[model samples]
Target: MSTTALIYEGDWVSGTSQLDEKFIGYVESMNRSGGLKVRVTQCDREDAVGTSVEAALAKVRKLPDYTPSAPEELKDLIELSLATHDKEWFDELSARLAAPQAAAEQDEEKRYRFTPYQSRLYRIAE
Candidate 1:
């Protein structure tokens, strides 16, 4: 058995209308798939300012013996979301994800940055 975890921010809406409806549908489909678990935590205005995807990833990396379990497909979805909704942030995230983790971690004091919409998704297979 193995489990994979994905933590990132989400943008449910751009204004009054819903955004990422297709992505939402995909998540619903995953829920119906039985082995997937999704957890979404909405950040308050203040919290959102202080939190970021990089910070989230950095925190996850700092966990004792922690490793990301998200499949390449899921990661691609995230990349797509960033590319569509937040190009600047996506550019930063893409560079970070592509960078070697070992090199990034060497600067232990580096701050993890992310957008306002933070989310975490994971899957367990048995």
Candidate 2:
């Protein structure tokens, strides 16, 4: 069976509430910062296991604002959480997140150096 893994970082809450001011703000921030990378693996199965990552995301979106962070259409998220705790899977996910930082450093090191303007009076003798 093919299985798709969608990886994202956040404490998924069941429902929206203002009672816990701190948690509400945190979750809202996560919702706004949508940089989470979802790596979907195509699984060969019929149930939720076979559902595409896109489908899983859609399900999450449909959840009511009051749903708790535990279940509430979080089957896919739960799977991701479990996978993240697995040594092998967590290592892979960590690598994926680190790639961009490494790439940025490499790009900085290879950046172009600006040359002085080729003005007639300021031209350097060859």
Candidate 3:
């Protein structure tokens, strides 16, 4: 396995074992040795759920972020925020509902700078 993805604590990941067992969860802790402890949120094996499973960094990838579209969806999210007592999330959801186009534009923007593979990204002046 290649260390191509950046792994971090709290990232949602799916860990795969050598035996082909898979566990989905958020990373609880990351070790400098390229292993991590994952608090299993789900697994094919019933007993593994809610247990911490150890795995190598190469076996996991961060889950992509999700953005709910539509006024109804945003409203539903606001309700979830209220239920969870997440005031910051409530505020953000409300703002998104109020200005959905702006939020959509932001979502379309690149999250990070990209450089073409095998190509120089900078120019030198004489």
Candidate 4:
């Protein structure tokens, strides 16, 4: 799956409103194509930005394993993380994304690296 990271700054309401518009369009297109059903989850900014690493890790540990319904959902997750501009959150997400690729390449004895999606994400996150 391909992911593009977009960076933009504005008042919170306007910025998020624009994101919402694009997200709705994407979801509608997926629905029209009879693609995988997308489930949107909303988190408060405080929860997203203010949670401690330990608390966040604990919450993630308690959650069920993810099973993405479609490739698009993964792309959405990357894009959403980029939009937040939170370094810790972005780093954690990038590490999670790199894990599978690193595992797959371990036999080659090469360093683990970002896929293009993650590279773009890292660029924007910085």
Candidate 5:
């Protein structure tokens, strides 16, 4: 039976090979004949991260998309982005971490409904 392809370029994946250190990396390229090149990011074997490593499609499991909500988690991701020299990802994580504080300020504004007298006092002066 033919199976649907779930992995693609740039997807984070974990290795399923019988090695001492299981690698986690993003897919760099793929071949139609069940082969792929992964840019190893996190692994015990430090020497293998030089370029890209080859693996069978069946030997890699795609990692699920995740958005970390905790400040510590977001900071960790920001550090990782910096380590990888991914400016776009660094900006994204920084923005994501800052969004909550902005939203909290907006929520406070919404909560303090102004009276007619207070509204006039707070109105823009021409």
Candidate 6:
């Protein structure tokens, strides 16, 4: 069988691996706090970046009312918004969002990574 490649952080880690294999390898490289893995993977890429960001926001919204303590990258994203929009409003919203997200992370059940959906488009495009 021919192998399909999944690019991780624009680097080739495991070549010719199945989707699950590639995803497991990617998750292993992540830090447990702040959902940094999601932020980095979703926000960094050209192809899946926007979709990933949308997914992240949806995940965040689904969490219970808890606070996120260690959220440097998220803070930066909020700050970026403040730079463009209203600083005070964004700051308050950021704080509120941070708390629940932090609480959500404390749970053992939070699904962290983006699940890959298979498509024929990859083959068709090629």
Candidate with the greatest lDDT versus the true structure: 5
* Ranking of all predicted structures according to lDDT, beginning with the best and ending with the worst: 5, 3, 6, 2, 4, 1
The ten-residue window of minimal lDDT in model 2 covers 19-28
Candidate 3 per-residue lDDT over residues 44-107, each given as its tens digit: 9878888888888888777776688688999988999999999999999998887967866777
TM-score: model 3 vs. ground truth: 0.63
Q: Return the TM-score for candidate 2, rounded to 2 decimals.
A: 0.27
Best prediction by TM-score: 3
lDDT of 3 at 5: 54
Candidate with better lDDT, 3 vs 5: 5
Estimate the Cα RMSD of every predicted model relative to the unseen true structure. Answer: 24.8, 17.0, 14.7, 22.2, 8.0, 25.6
Over 12-122, each residue of candidate 6 has an lDDT whose tens digit, in order, gives 122112211111112222222323133223322345432222111112221123344456756766777778887776777687767776777766354554346633335
| Selected candidate, larger TM-score, 2 vs 5 | 5
Candidate 1 positional error at 100, Å: 1.3
Candidate 1 error regions (>4 Å): 1-74, 82-85, 101-126
Q: Model 1, 6-123: lDDT tens per residue?
A: 4212312111102111111011112222222112233233333222211112112111232343446446756786668977756665555666665657556455644455445556
lDDT computed for candidate 5: 0.81
Q: What is the TM-score of each candidate against the true structure?
A: 0.21, 0.27, 0.63, 0.30, 0.58, 0.20
Query: Could you give candidate 4's per-residue lDDT for residues 1-126 as a string of tens digits?
Result: 211111111101111211221111011112222222222233334332321111111111112235553445655666787898766766666666777777778956655556678666334554
Sorted by TM-score (best first), the order is 3, 5, 4, 2, 1, 6
Q: Per-residue error at 7 for model 3, in Å? A: 1.5
Clashes of each: 8, 19, 0, 0, 0, 6
Instruction: Give the distance in Å from residue 109's predicted Cα in candidate 1 to where it truly belongs.
Output: 24
Q: Please identify which of the two predictions, 1 or 6, would achieve the higher TM-score against the true structure.
A: 1
Q: Which ten residues in a row have the lowest lDDT in candidate 4?
A: 6-15
